[model samples]
Target: MINKGANDLGGFLRSRRERLTPDAAGIEPGVTRRRVPGLRREELAELAGVSVGYYTRLEQGVSTSASDAVIDALAAALRLDPAEHEHLRILATPRRPTRPRARRSKLRPSVRDLLAAIPGSPAIVIDHRADVLAWNRLGHALLAGHVDFDAPDSRVRPNIARMLFLDPHHRALYRDWHAKAQVTVAALHQAVARHPADPGLEHLVGRLAVDSPEFARMWARRPVRTCSSYLRELAHPVVGRVTLVNETVTLPDDDQQIGLFYARPGTTDADALILLAQSFERRLAPGTPSRKEEAR
Candidate 1:
């Protein structure tokens, strides 16, 4: 197992250093010698408004407590994208103090009601480990029509990342599987950093690393990504290809995440999504019952 804490810090510094070129950072390359690919330590220190020795120590993983001002300067100097910048902050800072793990209680009545009310949009509430804690009817239909929904404790419940890398059916559903897989692995990497002691997440990562060579390579790359929003191309069997935007909102009280998938209006993709919604409704109609009945 990788020492996630050290790896997170080392990976961020290395990524930032690799991305900043001498030309990009306005540093003139000397004719005498040039060995490093990106910005040299001295040049990066100059750009980041810090001493070369201090920056060197940081890059060496000898120190983690660079002030906010220093972090901002480094972020600006390296020209980090927003997500990368946020990830840098997370990597440099200490994990927030947390209590021992506990089995999360059931969702509040209001949240369940809210999911029920969203008839058209597909949405689900998941835990930190990407376990599908709850899902709206549309969400159930949109993602995994073959699975039973009523039994939340069922072992067969869909895990978004696991499905992305392990299940052929789910992999085929994604038109941009490579990009989606990268983001998924990156987000999981970030989660690993945040929750290093989570055995469940550790086990999941271990399983993926063993089961999928692509996942193993991507995990080795150590990309840190945040799941705020992203676009996905989903190839639904019934709906065909539909471009959807996924947004994640964190629940305040717990380590739960609510994800919403939306398709833009005034497009063929949107029409297909509507058809999918209608198909789901038909499946839930009088004669056609839920999967709970079929299993019995």
Candidate 2:
């Protein structure tokens, strides 16, 4: 598995450069037929104002470091977005992570209180490794009422990435599973790059690479993203259907985030959220079997 660091820089650069054609990059195509789809290595090196030998060394992972000016020129040549540019820098010159616990990270009580305060909304807190640290009652009901609400507090906590790829119950929640799966993989790439020393994160990637062919394929593609908000459509078993505006509030100090989902006001979708709250109130009991378990 490709854990994000100096190792994947070459692959990531190759992937990005392969997607840009000669015409798109303002390079003239000569009479010679090209073997590759996009800009040739020498052409890209010329565009970025670097020598062919040096650029070749960089792309082949022989040269692990690059100056800021070189990174800027390469980012410009590749037409990388802000996120991709950040990712390139991280891979090219990785900073030692200040906090590398390599174990289960904890949630602050204040964050849990905030989730509880938003009773009608579906709110959850997840750490950098995508472990579900905590979720309010409505959040639990809206996403995974089939599982115990307190599962996050257990020794074996719920992991969002694992659920998305490995759990059939969680997969059924998404109306457009592939889209979310893509985002999840990209987000994981960002996380892995930022915290390369985190063993839990490494193990998560390793396990998914082994278990899910689809995830393995996506992982190999080297997508990099950092998410702040998302628009998602869910075919919830209880709610039937609802479109949620998911906003992520990052806690940089703790490497955790609070995810809040809201529907537009005065719509049927708004009413459905209330129904989820009520359903949770009706059936959520300590040690009681979840709806999925009862079905079994």
Which pairs of residues collide in candidate 2? Answer: none
lDDT of each candidate versus the true structure: 0.77, 0.84
lDDT of 1 by residue, 44-123 (tens): 88988899999988888788667789889998998887887877777778766675454343566677778878877899
TM-scores of all models? 0.82, 0.91
Off by over 4 Å in 1: 32-34, 95-106, 155-157, 224-227, 264-267, 281-296
Number of the top candidate by TM-score? 2
* lDDT of candidate 2 over 158-275, digit per residue (tens): 8888999999999999998998999889988888777767788888898898899999899887787777889889999987989989999999899888889999989888999988
State in Å the error of residue 113, model 1.
Answer: 2.3
